[model samples]
Target: MMPLSIYFLAPSLDLACFLAKLYICCCIKYVVVLRSYSLCLFVFLLQPVEKLKKMDLSYSEHLIQIPNLCGAINLESINLQGCISLVQIPSCFKNLDKLELLDLSDCENLKDGMENLPLNIRELKLCRTAIEVLPSSVRFLLGLLDLDMSGCNKLKDGIENLPSNLKELRLCGTAIQVVPSSIGCLMGLSHLDLYNCEKLESLPKSIWTLKSLEWLDLSNCPNLIELEDCTSSSLRYLKISGCTGLRSIIALPPSLTCLDANNCTSLEEISSWWTPTVQDYDPQVQHQNNKSEGEIYNFEQCLKLGHDTCINVIEDGARRRILSALDVYLYLYLFLSLRKI
Candidate 1:
């Protein structure tokens, strides 16, 4: 074989001119590859910056990963949402102290949450990823506020000892049967959305003590049997729709403004907090006031309260009734006004 440099230096007009220069550059000391992997050859490096910030790589399907993001120590937000081919993150991700938001949602190839992350990370989203376990090191992220891990079907059990300062946590559509007891310590938690968690059977009793919680969504949790009576002073909205296994709902806190309990097929009991006088009332009042109560409680398709399918109504003088999502409100208001009789 002829020498490689002599073959390339045989200058044709367009092609040979570029190849000869590449050969000379390769011959020099420019390429500093440590362990040249025969499979793929690309040394991607970030341009040096005084203060790099905000990398929004959303919907980049082919981008596998970024190497050693710690090189840019001032990076604040790294949005890698819907990066389908991304398998793993760089090892030095934890060194970036200013990283506040890290969105890795819809990265299907990621198996587990990386072992270490920036301690100041405020918002971490892993929705629809293949994460099987949340690494124990997550406790050290003291500044974390929002953590959204919805649609991680592989996570049968998530992490414990989450940051106490966390505000919002969304764990919708996972296989987890129970939430970690350590989560009860998140006193500052404002929004806890567990939508469509079909396997969740119960919640930690300590959840009721979350004084700062505002919105709690447990919609479509068919296996959820009950909720601890909520005492949160800040709780405003609650959703328990499609929870067929729920046997009863305890008396709600005074602060609760909205409650959605639709499609609770097996709900056999309900708490009594309707009457201002705290006296028992009748369900017949629902039909009497149906015309005026449309805005408050519309019972367009409610199974008649006297029907055999009506299992049991709010635990009192009223007979049991298997009402759908809409009709629950009708009976509530009707019974409340019945106290006037």
Candidate 2:
């Protein structure tokens, strides 16, 4: 056989070129494979973005407008809280069939031009906005349970045709002078907050129909003078503080656990049938309308003084002792009279 070195030298350059081309081809194939793998991985990770069901864009200064969020068919909640620059909610929002919660609290620039929210929304907060009126389309929110519109200073018009299924409604800090009688239609309402509505003078007689109402706050409604016809049997908490014009409380329900009338100086009389457990009874203050010295009487003390005297009595340890003796005498007299009969 010929020597191995002699045969190897004859085809050395040809073999080198062939080997170089083969190595280059392998390097190109590896680069292609890596690029394809990276692209596939990226696509896999981004697939779930389409499945997003909840979004919160609060305090994001760059978010000046709401995009077409209707594509998110399964979206259940959207919170844009404190997005002060947001001026309006897109009209397409009505297309969100599954939306349940929509919070736009403190969106001060959101004006009255926006209209028609989705009917499926169960909770909504639009506090501290410029909204002046609610559109008639609001009646379409059949499933709404909680609606808060507090601090909408420009809101002077009354809400018409609210949903009957509403459970909690807050209209505090508005300029509304009257609440619509249509509010009586909300049979399921349990909590109503109308605090600081200074211009509100009277409540509709229909308010007596809220049989399911448990809490009612009418504090700081200075213009409110009469509640003779409005009474709710289910109300457990009632606050009428700062109602300086109110002179009487009539037809008070016995179910009340808390009654706050601390600053209502014009209240000259409390009915015999309605007596609340006393928490703080201060006697130094005088009545607002009359210069006569006023007194604070608790449930037990009121019974001893009788309805007429209770109005003049004040809270003092000495006065309480005297009232107790009077009560004993009255009871003894009643007992003797029954025996003689």
Candidate 3:
């Protein structure tokens, strides 16, 4: 047996054993590298972010206070949305020169102390706050773009003056009977939302002079009986839902693209012998991006007025439903359109 020594088989067995050992060594080295990498990642995650830029403590109802934010020199945005019990921000907040946005929406306990905010602030959202009166210093914020005070039920007529650079203003449910005439100073105002303003009776005559006015929402204003002529070249969307006191729609701007006058049972006529002015629209594609606006109204009373010429409510309703998709709007539009024929 030793003469030939089974040379071929013995050498093959030795080579196989060597290769198995090398494979095991490589796997062990790879596992060690993976463990080191995981340790480094864990350490990075545990590091503190004391130099934070944006601080969002939204929905922190239990959190009663915040530390001095002067240390955060680069802080630009602060959102305290729905912090119901929050009374006020730290007085040192004025040191935030870089702050550009602030939102205190739905903070019921916040009554005042926002008089002197950072001048660079471009947007302020104080919707549903307990603050009944706006600060006089609001006129100094020349960079302000939007101001939302919706659902502030106690705010009656405090908005006598506003930033001239304002582009959007929302005062829904404020219960103000008359709009401030100084609103016309905002030549840049494009969008205005006054939905569910039940106590609003009249509008400023200067409102019609806004050339940049594009969208106006006056839905559910039960006492609004009449609308003045709107000649804004950019005016497009308008809503007048639940205006039971209104009897007519006259002198509407030619730039109108959408109108909602639903449940206006007292509405008798539009434009006095009005015919639907055919507008250029995309019949194939719908405005799926728009919110749930443009509700359908029954214009049977307007038809019974026995005017010599009239606009077909079916054509208007079906077109609106096709665009906005209100609840049960599509079915009603189809039925009414067919019945009209």
**TM-score, per-candidate, Cα-based:** 0.69, 0.66, 0.67
Clashes of 1: 5
Alpha-carbon RMSD to native, per candidate:
11.5, 18.5, 17.4
81 Cα displacement, candidate 3 (Å) = 0.9
In candidate 3, what are the lDDT values of residues 201-287, reduced to their tens digit?
A: 888878878878878899888888888756433466777877777766655654455667767666766653212222322222234
lDDT of each: 0.62, 0.62, 0.63
Global fold similarity of model 3 (TM-score): 0.67
Q: For candidate 2, write residues 17-38 as lDDT tens digits.
A: 4324544443211110000101
Backbone clashes per model, in order?
Answer: 5, 0, 0
Pairwise TM-score winner, candidates 1 and 2: 1
Error of 2 at 248 (Å): 1.9
The parts of candidate 3 lying over 4 Å away from their true place are 1-50, 272-341
Query: Which wins on lDDT, candidate 1 or candidate 2?
Result: 1
